[model samples]
Target: MLAVTILGNNSAVPAFDRHPTSQVVTHDGVNYLVDCGEGTQIQMINYKIRRGKISHIFISHLHGDHYFGLVGLLNSFGLLGHQQELHVYAPSPLQEIIEMQLRVADTRLCYQLHFHTISGEALLVDNEKIEIRCFPTQHRIECYGFTFREKRKPRKLILDSVKQNNVPLHFYDNLKDGEDFITSAGEVIRNEWVTTAAPKGKSYAFCADTRYFEPIIDHIRDTDMIYHETTYLDNLRERAFERFHSTSKQAALIAKKANVKRLLIGHFSSKYDTLEEFEKEARDVFPNTDLALEGVTYRI
Candidate 1:
């Protein structure tokens, strides 16, 4: 099962009811923390998220609202006696900042910490079941978004077809790979007679913090679920543009254009006390849009 849990949803500052940006994506048995804002560890605890299960942490940009909790989370991981290897993916200067923090504290982590800086347009991380690709997003500073796609297995060979046709067991592998089998008598066994294509897997996209840019539609096209930042309402459109952020209506447009199944919008500006307006604005444009409430879990 693939799911995303919202740890914090507020944009810049933590309010009494809302928090800064942070989320945890759970795919298979692995967990990935995206955009560790301030008080994220406490947020994780409040949400009952298993911090030790997170193997990777992804930072969208250097904005404090998006990454201020990183150092604290890392330090807490060490303090918790976490021994598994941890990987961090972020922009260039993040490594320097983390290293500086470690240096000042004179602390060494218990696990192997790996840092990979994203410089180019796309960075791919392939595993046995899931593949993640990071793409550039238009923001004030160098920023990026991530696409997580689950890979499908090869098609299954039809056992009844093989038995009825007297095909040998050794040729099953070829049939599963969509290849025709050749017999000793030079008979060609059609792939359609023995195999069927695998079912298409699902994908999730996180379009962190960015302005309304049409180019991103291609990268997030037809995603099963997309989490985009809606930091302002339609009335604040000018302010959103001035701050290099997106309004709820603009984010809904991207989700609508990309044809995503569901749009989860968060990173709301702290100025708004009630999020009902944001939800109404987005749902007006895209009916499937929903507010990304803190502590809520969304299944993809």
Candidate 2:
């Protein structure tokens, strides 16, 4: 299963009981953190997320709201005796920034931490279960967005059919791999006759802070779901453009253009005390749009 749990949904500052920016994308029991903003660890604890399962972290930018809580979390992992190696992917200057913080504090992590500097479009992780890639986004400073695509599962065996064919248990793995079985007499037992196709894999995209840019439509096209930032209401279109941020309507338009199954709108500006208007505006354009509320898990 593929899902995203929102840990923080606010932007720039924490206000009205909302946090900055952070989320956990979980697949097959593994957790991948996206953007560790201030109060992220607290939010994780509040939501009961398993911190030890997180092996990778993807940071979009160096904005304080996006990464202020990273060092603290890393420190806590050491104190807790986390043994698994941790991997962090982000743009440059972040590695330098984080190293400085650790150095000044004279901190040493118990687990190995690997830093992968993101530049342009790059494949960050490709394993048996999932494939993760990063793409550049238009922002005030260098930033990137990530796409997580789960790998297709193996076909399922038809137990009764296999038994009727007298197929041995030793060949069950091959049957699941879609391979045909043959008898000593050369009688072929077609794979499809005893197995069913697996379900299609799911995909999700995380569009970091950006303006109303259409180029991203190509990267996120036809995704199962996407989390796009809507830092302002549609009424503040001009101001949003001036500040390199997107309005609610703009995010909806992108989701509509990309033909995504669902659109999650968050990264809300602190100026708005209420969020109903943002949801209303985005849904006006894309009916499937939903607010990315904290502590909520949206399954893909």
Candidate 2 residues 5-75, lDDT tens each?
99999999899999999999999999999999988999999999999999999999998999999988988
The residue-by-residue lDDT of candidate 1 on 42-139, one tens digit each, is: 99989889888999998889999999999999999999999899999999899999989999999999999999998656756787688888888889
TM-score for candidate 2, residues paired by index: 0.96
The true-versus-predicted C-alpha distance at residue 170 of model 2, in Å, is: 3.0
For model 1 the local lDDT of residue 278 reads 90
Clashing pairs in 1: none
lDDT of residue 176 for candidate 2: 91
Question: Where is model 1 more than 4 Å wrong at Cα?
Answer: 166-174
> Residue 51: error of model 2 in Å?
1.3
Q: After superposition, how far is residue 281 of candidate 2 from its true place, in Å?
A: 1.0
lDDT of 2 at 232: 100
